[model samples]
Target: MTYSASMAVQRLFPTDEGHDLLDLTREVVAKELRPKVDAAEAAAALGEEFPTDIFRILGRAGLLSLPHPEEFGGGGQPYEVYLQVVEEIASAWMSVAVGVSVHSLTAFPVTTFGSPAQREALLPGMLSGHQLGAYGLSEPLAGSDVAAMTTRATRDGAGDDGAGDDGATDDPAYRIRGRKAWISHAGHADYYTTFARTSDARGRGISCFIVPGDAPGLSFGAPEKKMGLHCDTVREVIYEDVPVDAARRIGDEGQGMPIALAALDAGRLGIAAAATGLAQSALDVAVAYAKEREQFGRAIASNQGLAFLIADLEAAVLGARAAYLFAARLKDAGRPYGKEAAVAKLLATDAAMRVTTDAIQVLGGAGYTQDFPVERYFREAKVTQIFEGTNQIQRLVISRHALG
Candidate 1:
């Protein structure tokens, strides 16, 4: 009937700053997200609505850019700390947590692969918390295969014709014309971190660009009706001769594939953290219900059969958290975390699916009803396994690492 301010799960931070950051995150979650998530998600499911205000609230609080450089207006926290903050946010609102993750993903290429000049120019706005971003990687035809994207970026003559040897062009240098599918915050983002093919070469042909949201030929499709996470609006980003400056490109031409792949490794850990939070929320709700709901002559939780199920749910949530945290620590240490990121994503999302299902079972018929949030949690959990590289794709990634 009521959501707790905090769950029973214990957290340990590596520093006082980490502790303070989480405390700030919890304060924001309590004040900003918890009060509006239910009504917002319900309203968004019926029509086109996005919680731009909530993102603004997070942005103003410095929560949106926690994992980037401080000099660039980010919080400059380590990934481990950042992910825990995401988990805390997700415990109250999954959509916002996902938005945070997606926003972080959009800035990744610029932060990781951009030239010093690009970082100096772009990082200020991207990490300023006043702006939101969308990732333009997946297409309708190329969901998991980055190399299969057909979006093309042809060179414009503006740069070739006496544009100065310094690579400074007043006019656009490339025109991106293609559609990016399933882009979150499509119409609402301030910028899009886009990838498009620049040549005929299969994998090496792609290039990354930071496309302005209001580009002349850029447009969006109608929002897709979805089962859950309604406030995280998704639609097609149509780029029809969307002109981009030479400076907007994040990495060198023909280097988009490697950039995208590297970014995905970090993105997977974000989803894993969020899934764990969702599962933890479900478990908390189930536990509270089990302790109160009377059956026969006593509480349902008094029964060993049902009690064991709750125990298992706790374990699942813990394991999921641990998996993501391990991956986050690896990333923070500047170690190779791609395989571990895949493993964490695979384990945490699958755990989310199982734990949420069992939580509903723990509630019996009530969990299936809209009166409870478990049903919504169940719906949200299904997509985590599908996005950020599906579990099947994750297994393949793991297998490749194992074989090598």
Candidate 2:
């Protein structure tokens, strides 16, 4: 009935620094995360904001900005390590898990393709916990099929006043007009890495922009009533003639798809790690319940049927962990991991769905109510399969890669 490192079960990836990140991450989860999970979940379900103190505490612990350089107020941890940290936190709370993934997504494109000036100007706030970010790529018309995005970014004449103090001005800055749907942290973020069509027609027409939250004509619609990860906000970001300078743009003019996809690739890996963690948590809850919940004058753990269910969950959780770790290793080594990312996301999320359902089975009627956390885990795990690209879309990505 106790959770130990041995019973908690994470296979160590073979990196010295990675091991350190995992150890520290487990400590952070046990101390900082587990204590606050019930309160956080309660607040989230009430549609209240995540505790700002939690974010600050994570920032102070160097959990928020891992995988970025120390100069920018980050932990300078590698992606492999950062993902492990994400998994640990996610095992405790899915909302915090999604928030960190969104943060990493918001910062990645800038660090990868921003002009040095742009990175120097804006990254400090992003890394310092002073600024939160949302990546706005999915529109009402475009989710997995991003080329269909109708959001337009017209090139205005020269001397455009699109630049802000963040070094995001363009000589021929674009005027963005679009609605990004299901944007995580939409109303709450200080900035959004949005994509819009800058040229004629579909395909290569899209371009990226880093729009500030206070930009004129920028606003968010009402939050979505979601099934899970309710701690993280999701809304539609509206851009009505929002000015965007070329300086705010990351990568080249026709490079939106690649940039978005690459960032999504990394984001998917984080999601997989997170989903695996959720599955693991569900397994833990089921195991604990089976050990203590007596039936027929004996603990349910002694029953053959319940014992086999626990065994199956163990295998599934381990498989999911291995899937995500393999993807993390590839990404850490700077390899092309598009297919691997999709696979990790798909398998891990599916495992979460299966394991959580079985967790409820273990608890019988008790799992069906708010009296136990397993039902909440069941609800929360549902969204991981839907967002970060649907499981169906992940399959498409994998199929396309295999064919190509």
Candidate 3:
């Protein structure tokens, strides 16, 4: 019924600041996010209501910008510490955790690749949580093939079209026309960091733009009925002659692929941490159930079969945590972490898929229903492997890195 990672997980973070931040994170997740999860998820599954209120609570708490600079209203923490916060929150509620991670990913382009003027003008509100962002990269045909995207951003004459300054700018603009599928915060975010083709070259033609939610011709499809993470809504972001100011562009033309891959290198680690937390939560529920549930005059956990399974699940959770933590440390230390990020995502998400399913086995028939949260965890675990680049794509990244 409750969620907590092992206390020993703190040993991974040696600094006092890490401990304090994670302590605050645990308190927030337990007090605010966990209690409302079931009902919120149920409601979201039936309608288009994403948890804007809970999201604002996190933003106000400064959890929304953990890895960004303090100058831009971020927490200014290292990814190593930020990711643990993600894991902790995820143990309580995967949807909120995913939402936080996606929001962070949405900010990456502007913060990391944007021009100085763009950062000064936009990053403050974005980092401060006055605005929420959705990353628009994956299209219906381009989920993993970044080169296959069809979204295009063409230079516009001027802002006379009047989208209310059009992402709050007066610079030359671009008319973006394309649909991004499987966007995490579609219909609910304040801005969209859109990627579109500016040339015909597969790898060199793509460009990134910060498209406002109110930009003309920007529309969202109805929410998709996904099998898990119900409260983290996903929908299509359609841009039809949507005018985005040139000032809102993140970087030079034809730089989107590299920028996107760079962001994914970090985002994958966030997802890896989240998947570990989900597995950890499922493990906790299974352990508690096994310890208390009686079976033929003995607790189910007393049986070697169930106990070893639980033990293995625990090991998998620990391994997953270690994998993501390793990648996060690499990122925090300012080392090249792309390959390690892929490895961590591959290990953690696959481990989550296995661990949550095994947790259900420990619960037997009781695990199949909504009475326990493990079923939800099981469903949630599945998508982690599919998104942030599929586990298949992670393998490709890893293999290429290793061979090179």
Give the best candidate by lDDT: 1
What total of clashing residue pairs does each candidate reach? 0, 3, 0
> lDDT per model, in order?
0.91, 0.82, 0.86
TM-score of each: 0.97, 0.93, 0.95
lDDT of 1: 0.91
- The regions of model 2 sitting more than 4 angstroms off are 1-7, 11-20, 160-172
Off by over 4 Å in 1: 158-168
Model 2, range 184-255, lDDT digits (tens) per residue? 888788899998888864567888888888888898898887777777878999999997777777877878
The CA lDDT at 237 in model 3 is: 93
| C-alpha positional error of residue 36 in candidate 2 after TM-score superposition, expressed in Å | 2.6
* Candidate 2 all-Cα RMSD: 2.6
Cand. 2 Cα-lDDT: 0.82
lDDT tens digits, residue span 305-365, model 1? 9989888888888888898899889888999999999999999999989988998999999
Candidate 3 wrongly placed segments (more than 4 Å): 1-8, 158-172
**lDDT value, residue 155 of candidate 3:** 81
> Residue 110: error of model 3 in Å?
1.5
In candidate 2 the C-alpha lDDT for residue 143 amounts to 86
